[model samples]
Target: MGLGAGRPAATRGVLARVSTAVVVAGVLGLAGACAGGGGGGEGGQGRLAVGLLLPGGGASRFGQFDRPLIEQRVEELCPRCPAVAVAATPDPAVQRQQLESMITRGVDVLIIAAIDPKLLRPSVEAAHRAGIPVVAYDRLAQGPVAGYVTFDGAEVGRLQAEALLQAMAARGKGEQIVMMNGATSDPNAGWFKEGSLAVLKGTAVKIGKSYDTVGWRPENAFVNMRGAVAALGGGSIDGVLAANDSLAGAVISALNATEVRPLPPVTGQDADLAAVQRIVRGEQYMTVYKPFKPAADAAVDMAVALGQGRPVGSIATRTVDSATTEDIPSVLLPSVAVTVGNIKDTVVKDGMYTIDQVCPPRLRSACDKAGLTG
Candidate 1:
């Protein structure tokens, strides 16, 4: 089950980076004002206790970028505040428990990338009743969230679908492509799928098979891809719209296993190092790069403001409505489409990943051929 579908939302303010000086002064001033323990909300206690919860951590972009970046920004803004409490898990029940425990510990504000948005509603509500402000990060939680931050998901899907169609141009009309979508439990998955369908519908590309990958797991994607191959036949499938780099790798693996000669182009997101290498090696077509710094900085600003009992409208550039909430203040960031041609210009230039990380020794020749090493 998914949250009730709501109005289409875009992070219309992607170009406007977070104004750190203004946000920092606002937070610190508010904290100082509340130093006498005035009624400034949950953070009126002088120093706020911020808790962060992410869906996944180990080796995922959350750990590689979001976590450290968020922590660093929080420290820079609130040098005297207690260190942000952090937890990561792919399990919704466990995440709920973690959130509840944070609430019990009296954290003033929370930033959560929910594993299951619907299941976390009760926890979010409970926090609301307990006077803690919840900031929805990455995934929107279904409750009274104070602020939201994430990339433009629809743009991500549109970019992937467009890249796929361009790659499959040789097939001309009626190209059969499989849609390897994300977990149905995630709202962003629905948005991505809808965005891609909007583009693919007008084209001659036919969606041969679509799978809502369980838990966004690579192994589940691999199993589904194998099933797709057996059912659709390897020769008939022209492209695969794998939702992220992990799934794209799985899709490519399944195709390799079935020995699909001259493998069809596969689309992915999250410019993971492995995905960049795969793009250079000509195994995958492209991935979406959503710069983590701006998103993290914005999230921290929102968290700090909410923690100190300040209005996030100053920090939020636009508004988004989740299934249960309407006109929630939000910061929507933009994403870039990355391919072999712009690997250096996009990811490397942005410092998301160094050339050595993307190239590695095994991919030296491929990197050279892609003009990344040369």
Candidate 2:
């Protein structure tokens, strides 16, 4: 039986009454219907139609963890609910179309990790017009998004920058570093760069070169890193502040291609499996582990609640203002900096990945040295 099937008729009756009151109040337009009357019948007992639009699958996290975690949580919360998920390949146009399709298909709520928030505003507004609440997941999308769930983006950059500075400081002062930021279109990229600059500014580290990677693609990062290497002179760069693990991997690859001896510290986020392996092997410096479970759980909770015409105040503890919207309910989770020292405590302890999963055959020796037992 479905989740709603287990509920007593009396509970359904109460929900029907509340839904009627909500409709009379005319709070959320079509969204109010989604919460109350749109699902099954007069009793408001039916499966929720949820649409999940992820930015891309190139980032291993999106496919390997986030999608599954969110789907599982949504099923647990609303067994009868069906979640339609799609990856946009980092194309804003494709994402917009996907959003439109979901809206037209009558999805009760949308969880979007926008490829380009600005470009998706019109689609988001369209969903709003249709009375479907949108929840901004990970990346904040403009328009009347009902709620947001993500880590403190600026702090992610601050953590990466601070760790890079510390690593570079060990070599001596007056270091020069390259900044490989995410795509310019991503608002989180600007926030990350701002936070990183806030720390990098007034410091001994010289910003030798910076590039806003197009599409946040590894290839773009590789090309940019190569250019930075050429401009700064090979092996002269001190460290790299890569926006995420993918970029960090590309930067590391570029450094390797240049045969830069003693590769400088490179900072990343997402704590991707490869990045974690790089850290164990002493190739990458550190990564910011933004625990996706909490974020995913929050998004699922918010989506289910909003789909059922319930309030999101309890789920969203804070409010954030976007370029197009203000006082948007948000749940910004904290992030942790992961190095070889705490691999066990962070990813392993949290069961994000087993030690064996992270410590592949090639990385076994390094894993053992890092005190990570399989």
Candidate 3:
């Protein structure tokens, strides 16, 4: 089921109206703050402070896109509002401390991409107690979050599985595949696995083995893939459903070590620079391109709204239920399946990456074949 599948229309309409009013009030307050040199009276006016706590730097997207985009958007929307960002490096304990620090320091709002949703519940609850609104970014952090922003995670999994199935069509029925899932702590990982299972289960493909990489670490994935190769026997595996590009890289590295001829097709996500290059070189099959701009923008919008003590119903169209929070306002963006054929149309055209950025000198020939050249 989708995030907001069962909400009544009447409630949605009411939330929309509330959101519109909040937005207007927020705008007026922003103007007042600027005029007064960053200080206002009611409705959370003045210089707003937003805290951005990311999971880690493991995934390239967090640093390459999410942080800068969110910071830039926060500046653009509320120039007086300053966003303070910190990376937790996938440690829930460290994230908890960071949350406590942010709360202690008195940030007006927080945007958290949790390392472990359940583990961070207490911290989230602490933030709530302090009257600081939390906006869950990319991951659905448990607890009382004011809002959430992420891509359709289940669709991401379905896209990867569907692409893998197509790539493995020649192998046909009874083909063995290994599932290299992300960290189990991440809710998105479960959603991805669920969506992929929806496509791969009961089909011609047989799940030879599945491993949830701890902390979504490439090194851990490397170890897991190596073990899978040793146990399943090299060249026996048909395809690999890598949760994202980082894991795909590790899986590919493992396959390379075994010297598997005609390497099996692998699926990935995040469209990381290295992953895109892998696709160009035919080392990886495909990736799910989640345009981060919209998601980041939505998070910033919601952060500003919440910081200003305004409703986010207009910004967050959908409502998602978490382990502790129900009907939480959310903005779930769409994702695109990117193959070598459309790298230019998806990432390049969107200006997420330039031709030169993705196409290196050594990859020129491959880029030409993929039509990624100037």
Best by lDDT: 1
Instruction: Score residue 197 of candidate 3 by CA lDDT.
Output: 97
Clashing pairs in 3: none
lDDT of 1 at 226: 93
Cα lDDT tens digits, model 3, 1-374, are 33622111111122233322211001112333422221122465456667778866544578778877876775666575434344445556666667777788787778888877776788899999999899999988888888999998889999999999988985563389999998877888888888899998788778888998887899999999889888998678999999999999999998998788778999999999999999999999999999998988888778777887778877877788886778889888899999998999998999988999898899999999888877
TM-score list, all predictions: 0.88, 0.86, 0.87
Which candidate number would show the highest TM-score if scored against the true structure?
1
Error of 3 at 177 (Å): 0.4
**Per-residue lDDT of candidate 1, residues 1-374 (tens digit):** 22333332232232244222111101212233333231123444555667888877779889888888986776666555545446887666667777888788787788889878877888899999999899899888888999898888888899999899888885563379999999887888888888788889877778899998988999999999999999999889999999999999999999999988778889999998889889999999999999999988888778777777778776787888888887888888899999899999999998888888988899999888889873
State the displacement of the C-alpha of residue 331, model 3, in Å, after optimal TM-score superposition.
0.9
Q: What C-alpha lDDT, on a 0 to 100 scale, does residue 78 get in candidate 1? A: 50
Q: Write the per-residue lDDT of candidate 2 for residues 101-132, one digit (tens) a residue.
A: 77877877888988778778888999999999
RMSD of 1: 8.6
Model 2 residue 27 lDDT? 14
Over 4 Å off in model 2, which ranges? 1-44, 80-88
List clash counts for every candidate, in order. 0, 2, 0
Instruction: Tell me the lDDT of model 2 at 149.
Output: 86
Off by over 4 Å in 3: 1-43, 57-59, 80-88, 170-174
How many clashes show up in model 3? Answer: 0
lDDT score for residue 362 of model 2: 88
